[model samples]
Target: MIGDTPPEASPSPDASVSTGEKTGADVASAHKPSQPQSTESHAKHAGFWALALGSIGVVFGDIGTSPLYAFKEALHAAAGDGVTRPEILGVVSLALWAMILVVTVKYVGFIMRADNKGEGGVLSLMALAQQAIGKRTAVVFTLGIIGAALFYGDAVITPAMSVLSAVEGLRTIPALENSISNELVLMIAGVMLIGLFAFQSHGTAKVGLLFGPICAVWFASMAALGIGQFIANPQILASINPYYAVKFLSEHGMAGFIVLGAVFLTVTGAEALTADMGHFGRWPIQAAWLFFVLPCLTLNYLGQGALALTVLDASQAAGRPFEEMNWFFEMAPLALRLPLVLLAGMATVVASQAVITGAFSLTQQAIQLGLLPRLNVKRTSETQEGQIFVPQLNTMLLVGVLVVMVTFQTSSALAHAYGLAVTGTMVVTTMMAAIVMRQMWKWGWPRVLAFIVPFMILDLSFLSANMLRFFSGGWLPVLIGACLFTIMATWVRGSGILFEKSRRDSVLLTDLIDMLKARPPHRVPGTAIFLTSDSEVAPVALMHNLKHNKILHEKNIILTVDTRNIPRVHESERITIEKLDEDFKRVTVHYGFMESPNLPKAMGICRKQGLKFDIMATSFFLGRRSVVASATSGMPLWQDRLFIFLMRNATNPTEFFHIPPGRVVELGTQVSV
Candidate 1:
């Protein structure tokens, strides 16, 4: 697991297709001179409101479910021997203002404007920053990997936390409140979460239609319940003032700081607004938040505070100490508690879907950027390219979710770990965003600091607060993030060294072509498309064929695939061909990092370019390397073994590149790393 979308899902759209969709990056890109020009908006422009509505479900689900536990956990943490009214006000103030400053201002107002072409996400922004700097610097790469690594932690925890909190609501039902066992709650949550992951392979197109309406209703229900509580205790509205939040933190000492970690949960899913910017565009997510989602969430937290105060007054009148309670579920009138819990479960499920899909999108970007090994990617939807299922990622997420759920037991315990990963990612995002603004937007130091400092302060404050609870549970995400970072860093470094070594030992393509022309071998009839990472060098497979079989194809195409910094590559810019000789040609195919490559589709462009192409008549030659650890390798023994393990587990080139397996010829070579 890594981040929450529409709680943490990335709606990775195409980089090839340009549109005037008013995405976050579009506004920011205006300051940069070299950005791609925008064309007319999509045909779905008529459904502007509809897209906004759908974004509510997919983009804000994770955060929308926060009221289920955020306030309650804050109250629990703030309770020093006993619950107090000021603490209640402080908790509400923190929750509301955290959203306003962190989610509304930093993300929606400023950061969303920092997108890659029309795309937005940790990786998209990372790539955009690289484009800004004119090269991939160590700073941008480190931040990207760190942000992405923390996302997996968020991915694992989101489902566990959201589902657990929703199912935990069952204890508030009158009939079950007295009888429901903790084991039963855990079992129900475990089953539902496992089922959610299982259903992912089937794709969400049909069921996703219901997401908007369901989430819309969930928010409406929350708003209505909150309004009732508001009417009963309108005084709670004062908590929206930032002064109370400031006062609480300043006066309450370490207790308040500990509670701050709990309060950060309110904005845990804020990253989704930026992550899914590509999917729904800037205006829709912004519109959804500014008009609808923000108001509903603010009201709900207010209502929870109001309701908690009411319970407190009643308890004080009864001459008993005021006790912390599950104010979210209890806010429902006794008769509707069960229905509310059911809707909560539905909302949580929907949110979890976003988080999981975010994981898939993040992994896709990671692989495209060469930070990860190629996993088995299966497109679940024929019409929609973004709807993909990664089998390995899915299994990893499911296992991580289950393990987290079992270990945390309740959402309250799990809450400590959630904000750490989310905030760490937020800090990383802010740092990268600063670089993008400085370099891409050409912001001066004073301007960059002025614009980015406040957001950095907020992110770091929350991250530091979460760190206070390291032993309690905050260490989990940190541990997970560190491990992921190591893997990514190792993979990147090892792959770089391997590529350099391979290039050093490989024969030059021009030299090979010249030699072949001088002394031609037995000629074959059809085309031989030899795929390699570097087209400047002759492919190992081609060299093997010439050395062993002592033959050459009549038409040999040296094919190379390169991933672009953009989301998708347009057909016109998909390929380039150079006729090195009558018998040999160099073909280069370009794809956006967000795209899955299909060699056949790329070759289709070759036919239109006066090159004869036939899939049936062509033999695809791929180099298969069996890497063994070497004592003199660039990396240590452990890292060498780890990279080899990753390479061994990487998906087959034919499958990864979407080539026909039938016409593929694998030439194996032993390589030392």
Candidate 2:
């Protein structure tokens, strides 16, 4: 019997196939080059400087803005003992090394190498890792979902914290201090956030053109301010040494350990470098980090440290308190402070934009991979396929950002909740990278341990420090991650169960075709396309149509859309057609997890292959399942209910697959699971 397996299903290791007969394994093997040959050529075409500039704008926004609040919060957290020179050096050291170890070594050096068709993200890496292991393991799947969930939590907090911190600089300006109240700051930040999200539907292609130049100017400003402070006091450069970091830990002990949470913020956006690698390419991101973003951030942090040290010295000499000074804002001169505030505000807005777009891209990938319910995904660019906007996700993110802004009220307050999500994602990325090194890269155990152990220690230490603030505010992200993780896990589990249940009751395609030939029903004169998840079984909609309508179309097509692990499928390999009999044909359409499915466009391609498609004469049949939670279902009662809710809320197949509403027929059926 001829059978077409679903892309997500596990394939036999030794399955044999003839020239015409291709199994799921055969198709996957044909595409799995591990490292595509196009990676180098693609990187070359973009040019190094162009890519680096692009990376600075899109990839470094979150971390680049860390100079605004990270150091200030660290000092505030350690205010119990009062600010000292060694403490200042120690905090700066921690921040610098965190960037070096976390961003430079773990992500840019190693994790970025595990790209799937030059696409890098937690889910993309998950697909690559799973393929290497020869099957999907529960551990890898959970890690991917958890990483993705934590990313969403970070997404919610970043816009609120970044823009709020930047705009709060208004209060620091003596001229605007009395005019801008906390309420006013919130109003402005809220407006900026709303504007950002509102502009998402129109897409980022045009605005993105300006991000590079604007971010370049922002980073230059950061460096200039920092350099001015550094030139005034060269002693702060000593913090670059690891000795201060060690002395800090030795002197303060547990208190110093807790400060790591704030320091972790210095590298919060490091993950973006890898996640956005596909957009800018690896060399450009790496080059931008090493040559541009990293240097600017380091100098800024050093300058902030130098300024703090000078303030502490003055306070000690004059017998005053050190609580009044915020080195980040103090670094700017009185005359330029207002303009600096404006620049910082724009930079933060850029930071927020990157994360919001990332959330949209992640949602699209999750939905394509079947880990999420279908959402309305709209492409924003004609040339850049990755440019997309999900309206539902944008609205939810805006609401979440505003809620966090209102509740936290200040960037310092929001900082506590921020580290948990960022650190959690970093730790997960480290773990996934370890798996990739061992399974995909085929590194020796010793080599893997050497590379992964240090990163794990750093990530876990940061995560543990953030956990100390759980009661303070860290629990917000934990709560958010838990909820999102549950949703993703439930959807994946529910879909698997439903697929199995549906497949069990389905008639085999070979058998159905043979039966139809022997006892044919009344033949209708138009083409009919039945969309099915699995091509081996007859579509439920086809069965329902035959059962009730009592007629078979003159030409029937069983259509199955399979999402591959790669980022995209070439047009030549996009559609596979099999003839079971002259009256019936089984067609499988292939898409990548990063690509959207367009049934009409795919059908047009099919037309070139002798499969005729007439929009007016052809009808697309889809099965609309009304799912109910049953006590006997495999999932727990709560999860079953959640799955039912998600299923109901999911976008209709007609809209999701781009099938014309006028030419589509949906047959509804109740299914208990």
Candidate 3:
């Protein structure tokens, strides 16, 4: 079992875990990888509740904050002329049941069990599916890319939407409602979101402990709010029946379908459940959702519906218009409403933090798997394996979020775009997961069909419902995802072509060793390590050094760093050494996709095996390539240019690998891809 999961692959020397070959320098990252507990018994462990509490802060934060705008938006959408009692019941029922089926049944019950070696996430699922198939298929690879692209879309919108929705809750306070203008609210949310993003670099280890208790209060307050309304109307509990959801949908034709899109807001962050399973473990997340989170969310929605029902009846009697307010914020009493706003704001910030962290983790996984170019990855915490931050991603996400917030201007408008990426991601996850169930879990065809078909239908229905808003703002996620997918596809295609070109241009390591032995070059004193993707072929840097300098080091190492399909590699299995000749040795270092590739720390492990990797006495040789666009490249000319752009912007290997610059030498080469 590995530590944390995020994504995965590459080949030749790169082909071990998920995909095929990445360049040697791409192996480095900012910090040493931390050891993660592989024990799958978190539920039985002493840290069970602590893990569950952490899950509340980091995992469910996204979905937990949904109540702020979900019912308000759904009710408004379905309320063509006015909200009827039946519509209230229906919207509440739909929201409740969607969470039950999607989050509870699909994710908690089934998807969590499909984890790849104790890791979860769409990419991890892709790796697991590839493992089950005994080879990586185009279908699995495409699905993984689509899911990850959609996630990036989600990552951008979640922060904007959550914060905006929570800040809008200030309108519920009588004192602040009249004082705060819509523009003022946007500015406030903007500042808050910027602050949250700014805080990301500091690492959440210290304050992360507080997340559990805060969310616990948030959930408890939601439950209390619901129960308070239940005192006035106990019959609202009847919305729990599926009959209301089905009946409401059957009666309201187009409007009900449109409401389905808005109802999806309830489960928008459901992916976090599966994505973060590795952080808190499967059991704690499940237990938290099934027991505390589910009940609180269900009750809150019921309370909102009940309050709406009361308002409807009072309006009908008075002959006035039935107004639909932000019922989540209104559920609290007048004096406590401001405090509720403060609490909601805190919860929303926490939600945004979770999505941001997820993005960083996803970036790390994508880079390790060769799906994306290497970025400046920094470790935020020494203790936690999942606490790294990617500066490129952080900046991109912050910009995207601010732009989205400004463009949409309201949580209501942002809601239109929110569900599209999330639903598409769910659909892709559902497909990939079904395959894993059939092949890996060995589920019968009938069982698999029964398990997956309903989810597919539901997800597709949600996706189509969201399509109605495509012209409005729904196209935002679709556009963002498309751009990201193009970039990833281009990178993969470009890297593969470049690797092929290198393989053809390179000499065989075995033959080179034999030739050198027949007529050995002038030997230097210290050890020299040349990183390569293929151990069979001589590294470009090694060849360049020998040809240009006309000398060789006394001791040489052909270092091949592998990112395994799993999340974390055990230290015992981290480094493998094979003696190639008197002067040369082959060293292979293995890391999980979720881990940072700290070469020095990994190499230090070799001392246990009678091979000492002396950092002070070693020289690191890196092959730096200038990738120019070629018309004959496998990718189009435009794509070739895009790949070159990405490569040029990627983090330098000396910094990325945490190698000392003074001890490193880079050999330059040109390649067309």
Question: Roughly what TM-score does model 1 have, to 2 decimal places?
Answer: 0.94
Which residue ranges in model 1 land beyond 4 Å of their true spot? 1-46
Against the hidden reference, what TM-scores do the models get? Answer: 0.94, 0.93, 0.93
Alpha-carbon lDDT, every model: 0.85, 0.84, 0.85
lDDT tens digits, residues 22-68, model 1?
54344655676664454323323445678899999999999999999
Candidate 3 C-alpha lDDT tens digits along 31-145: 3265233433342354667788889988989999999988999999998878778788889999999998898888887788887656788888877777677666789989999
Expressed as tens digits, the lDDT of each residue in 1-673 for candidate 2 is: 0011125723222211111222233355467667565764464455657767888889988888999999888877777767777888898898888888888988878887777767888887777767667777889889889999999999999999999998988887887889999999999999999999999999999988888898999999889889999898889999999999989988887898789888888888888877897787777788888888889988999899888888888889999888556577889988988888888888998999999989998998888877888889999898998799999999999999999999999998899999999888888888887787787677899999998888888889999999999998999999999999999988888887778887887899889988988999999899999988878888888999999999999999998888876777789888999988889898988888789999899998999998986778999998887888988767998998998898878888888988899998988777777
Q: Indicate the worst ten consecutive residues by lDDT in candidate 1.
A: 1-10
**Is candidate 1 or 3 superior in TM-score?**
1
Give lDDT for model 1. Answer: 0.85
User: Cα-based RMSD of the predictions, in order?
Assistant: 5.6, 5.8, 6.3
